[model samples]
Target: MRGTLLFDGRCGFCTRSRDLLARVDRHHRVETVPYQHPGTPDRYGLTEQQLARAVWWIDEAGTPRASAAEAANYALSAALGTTLPLRFYRLPGIRWLQEALYRWVSNNRQRLPGTTPWCEREPGTCG
Candidate 1:
């Protein structure tokens, strides 16, 4: 059940979100790493800009999911002890909504709680 969870380490909002997820992720299925960490994207085969724009989850099958919302639904399903919801969340229409919501958050995260405009400039050192 081990997988990688990549996030924006510099954004306070992102860090806080990771921290909260960490607290509830008792199975340790999710391994948290900052996108800016050395070798992070290369190890996971994700692009730098994509990592900055959204959270990513690398499943055991080596498939990398790029949408933050889909990643979140997976994480939530993992935490919830169920996979039905996550499966549904991945349907084309739902995935589209997830991507849209994720983009909105990524675009406005600078103004979100625990985040600052500077966080966007320094993806690994802002918070």
Candidate 2:
């Protein structure tokens, strides 16, 4: 696996997002795995709480790389064979904006399209 993408398997939106990534992963570089998979958190050295907060991408050796939007960026970049508007990471304020946007979307994911009524239910219920 070029990298492992740990996501919320139970979240409809997250699952859908993973599907989209797979569709574009012609070279199959990303290993998108749901954190709910047994022993996944331990394998990646991530806590359930951290996995709950956002998507995570770890390079092959299982080194923590990025989370949330940054993590997604890493996976997509690898998928398409081009780094995320990587220069943006160096631009003043751009990185902050990207992370902020991810937080907003994550915090309100239940309200986003593709999320079913059941997905809006109590915590674990959404999964």
lDDT of each: 0.73, 0.79
Q: Cα RMSD (Å) between model 1 and the true structure?
A: 4.1
> Which candidate leads the pack in lDDT?
2
Give one digit per residue, the lDDT tens place, for model 1 in 29-87. 77777777788778777778888888887776767864588887776666556787688
| Count of clashing residue pairs in every prediction | 0, 1
Worst lDDT run of 10 residues, candidate 2, spans: 117-126
RMSD (CA, Å), each prediction: 4.1, 4.3
The C-alpha stretches of model 2 lying farther than 4 A from their native spots are: 115-127
Model 2, 1-110: lDDT tens per residue? 36889888767778778878999999999988778777888877889999989999999888989999888888888888786555555478978998999999899876
Q: Find the candidate with the highest TM-score and give its number.
A: 2
Model 2 has an lDDT value of 0.79
